[model samples]
Target: MAVLKLSGTLNSEPQGKSHPEAGSDSSLSFLHGTKLAYASNLVRDWHADLLHYQGLKPGSAKLHRDNLLRLLNHARVAPWELQKDHVTRYFESRVNQETGQMLAPATVGTYCAAWRGFQNYMLTAERVNELFSEFNVRPKAFVDDDNSIAVKRHKLNWVPKGWALTDLEIDAIDETFRSEIARAAREHSKSLLPLLRDRVMFHVGIHFALRISELTELRVSSFCASLDADLQHFGKWGVLTVTGKGDVTGSVPMRDPSVHGLIEWYTNSVRQKILLRRKSKTEDDGRREIKGQMVSVSDLMFPSERGGVVCPNGFRKRLADIAMKSGVLRRKLTPHTLRHTGCTLMVPLYSPEIAQKYMRHKHLHTTLYYYHPTPLGAANEVNSAAQLFDDEEED
Candidate 1:
């Protein structure tokens, strides 16, 4: 207020916030949450909604948004009509081909929100402009009159909340793949290193419980236990930054010796195979695959025969075979089960908070699903010490 007074331009009501002596300047859209209710820049292209649709369908989130717009255009829904009520109804009206039933609640919430946000943006350019106007900026009016309308918020449900795998299940998969992997390696004329490959894949994933993507993205550098050249860095476990969902990166440590042994065996085999000179060898002088200060471990710690990124599904299939043979689980198990095993193992050793830190979970409750403590069904001492120490009554 004082600054405004000194500048000879006092801010009017509904524009600037006051602290009795001073105030600051900002867009009228700033009042969206307060007096205006969703004025401008408050939206994120409904990105979460788009991601949710993409999870159901196989396209980029933007492509999902485009498809939603096409649906609305076909419906001939007006710009203003793209409100929460209309959006929800439009999606509820969509039918599934498989079951011939109306779209599920989860699907409807996502598709409708994506459709409506895009429709609103295209048909109502004036809306973004009017965010500056004091007259009309009530997003609540689209669904609420007296704050009484029942409206559901739209958000992406991709990368679902509960999906960690169990240890027994992971072990089963590991065992299932062992013999078969060796057979396949022998048949394909490939080295026996892949059997070790499959084993290490199972071990690292179960012990550290890294995501399949994280496991595949691993580098030889990440497996290093030491960094100092003179200090003998090789054979030691190393930490690497893993980029996960939403491009969020986390540092996960490797502790399993089996993981290192398998990797070591594979690396030694790779060097031996290269020395033997069987296939088209890449020239050292020419542009190599790896760049930067550190020598990249040929793109991935686990590369396919063609030396490209390993197929995630192929890896899963291999592990599935292992699980079936391995007596750990009666049913099929996945890499995610390893994550569950990793968390479960930590339950007795650390607090949920510490487990969450290692797992890099935003919520500890996600870690809770993997943890189960043993129940006390019976006491070890059948006859209590109280019986032994009981005072004898005068007979």
Candidate 2:
């Protein structure tokens, strides 16, 4: 990878406090200028290492380098002055300068990955490590699972608060949505089909504990029933063979009567009506351009207003809108909230082992960490502790 060659005058006085370089490391201190020459050099070197040593493709290396530069530019600090606070601030800023909408979780996750990769390279590269040591500065991995959305379901939940929807909230949402659908039908509104589609999508997502991408990417063919007796846990309720993160395809068994029934209503009644409307509006044969590729909207379980795959952002907004309209759990609830809520409810209805299997998590700890020890479980634990004390006193 070619280095970012720039011609600019270096600032004599650095913005940050000066670290007294001992002996030979003093020579490298000059590189830390107010123009961020040090950061530029670090990124350029990391890009080359990614290409030559890590065997990353040229395009991939360039992307990593570009993302790193964006972060560095936003911070306006040299490598030594960089901190986790800078990263937090960068992510909190809007992606669109005019609209002022926060960066998407996926986009922030990508940038966080690039930052981690650069930090790892800095620690491993002998010369780079030595260069930082001489200046009394250490490269630290700031963006981690604790802060980044890549590992945590929501960026807002970095502090590990309760975001799962309660049973009462879920019921309120269902009632409100059903009422809205009934109202639309009574008035002969065009929104009736779309409302039904949204309702079905929401019910299926919460019941199945599906990620946003999995929910949006669902197709008619993805649903399967009549598996061998030994293969299914939910019997005739069927399973969803979805391509999840890392392109790992797995079967998510659906047992909820309401979920499967809602899906049936959508596929049999609502889906066909939407496709008919799409066919009338556009002469094209149910195929349209989506992100550069032509896709048949008729196959998608949850097609958008434009008869394409549902946009994740739009789906999130609709969920938020539903909560707001219902006046229940009016906090910022994303699609992942449903996943958390489902997993939370699962631990009580079934064992943690079953919940882990149902979630398809690689480790049992993940299931425990996110959704174990429900309110009832915690209370039971306290009661058990009290019983133990009582027994000890009696002895």
Candidate 3:
């Protein structure tokens, strides 16, 4: 296999940070000379092709780029030197760098898909020869026949154990935040705006089943309220255009009256306070720049105190603190915990099909895997079966 001895450490900076200048070639500083230029050109060309041919958004293409870089950095070998085993081992080694737990199978599948895309790109570029045949490096070998790592269904008597929250727990969390918001308002505390924001975010995450990224990236314009309708008079029926994984856009209906009320409150009252606070800051304070450009409060649904988009990490930490204060600190509470809770509750109230749509899952199987029968559901089924047996015996 031909090995390219690229000299330089991989760009260790945080992902998703924008370049300082438009169209500026920030060559990977860790790479040296011709090798750097070659790798950069390859990624740039691949990104352009994805955008032009596949209609992939720039963010989606960047994920592929980052995935490829991770593999290259780990293997320390040329693209041609990459074998199927190398790919498999790389995924196996992926643990939560902080928690030291294995990543979810779906996440690993994404890495496999990115690797497959890069392999296809190399083939199209005529880089594959006898020594580096496509068959020898097929990405399918890394996953099961369904193109996912096999995750077994939970036991019939299984209950949520940190993977998801119960409906009652969700209610408690909601009440906790609502009470805090009320207290802050009564006391005229500076935390009133933040408390209101957090409360609204909780509603959005639970009712819409949105991922943290989608929730935080939401813009005010994303919600489509009816025309000729005032904010107070508008009913709880609007469409939310959500940009989900893989850059796929889907519209989710906002049917929950409480969610609509929360949005109205946040927009009319709480959001204005946040904007005024931001407006009070001076330009020289360096709070205006976001991804190298100034952002307006109208551009974001949930802006930070500094007038930029809220950081996902900070939002999660705030949520955890709320969860702790609510006396539900038995397990770590994340935005995903609320998402799972919503999907699980949906399955019992509606059909799995509705749950799938509510969760915005592209596949029904994905919804079924996470929203299976609980212990109470199993007991109900057993009782119904016994009644059927009694009827048959009497007949």
For model 2, the local distance difference test gives 0.68
Q: Candidate 1 at 111: error in angstroms? A: 3.1
Q: For residue 158, what is the lDDT in candidate 1?
A: 33
For model 3, the stretches where C-alpha displacement exceeds 4 angstroms are: 1-51, 55-162, 226-237, 279-295, 348-350, 378-395
TM-score of each: 0.57, 0.58, 0.59
The top-ranked prediction according to TM-score is 3
Ordered list by lDDT, greatest first: 2, 3, 1
216-304 in candidate 2: lDDT tens per residue? 87777777774767546444448777767644567767767767667766778888878767523636577766434566777788887
Q: What TM value does model 2 have? A: 0.58
- In order, candidate lDDTs are 0.50, 0.68, 0.64
lDDT head-to-head 1 vs 3, winner? 3
Compared with the true structure, what per-residue lDDT tens digits does model 3 show for residues 40-82? 7767777788888988778788777777767766665545456
Off by over 4 Å in 1: 1-82, 96-100, 112-129, 132-137, 141-191, 223-236, 256-299, 370-395
| Residue 3 in model 2: lDDT | 17
Better of 1 and 2 by TM-score: 2
Per-residue lDDT of model 1, residues 1-395, tens digit only:
01111233221234363532112222332243443334223333344545664342334565444445434343443233335555445443444434556544454444445544554453455654554364454332232321111223312233444344444454455555666666777688464545556667777776666788777656655554445454343345555555565555666554455665565776677534532342334653211243123333353566555444456788887777665567565546677766776776654455456666677776665666554433341122332222322332221
Worst 10 residues of 3 by lDDT: 1-10
Candidate 3 lDDT score at position 287: 38
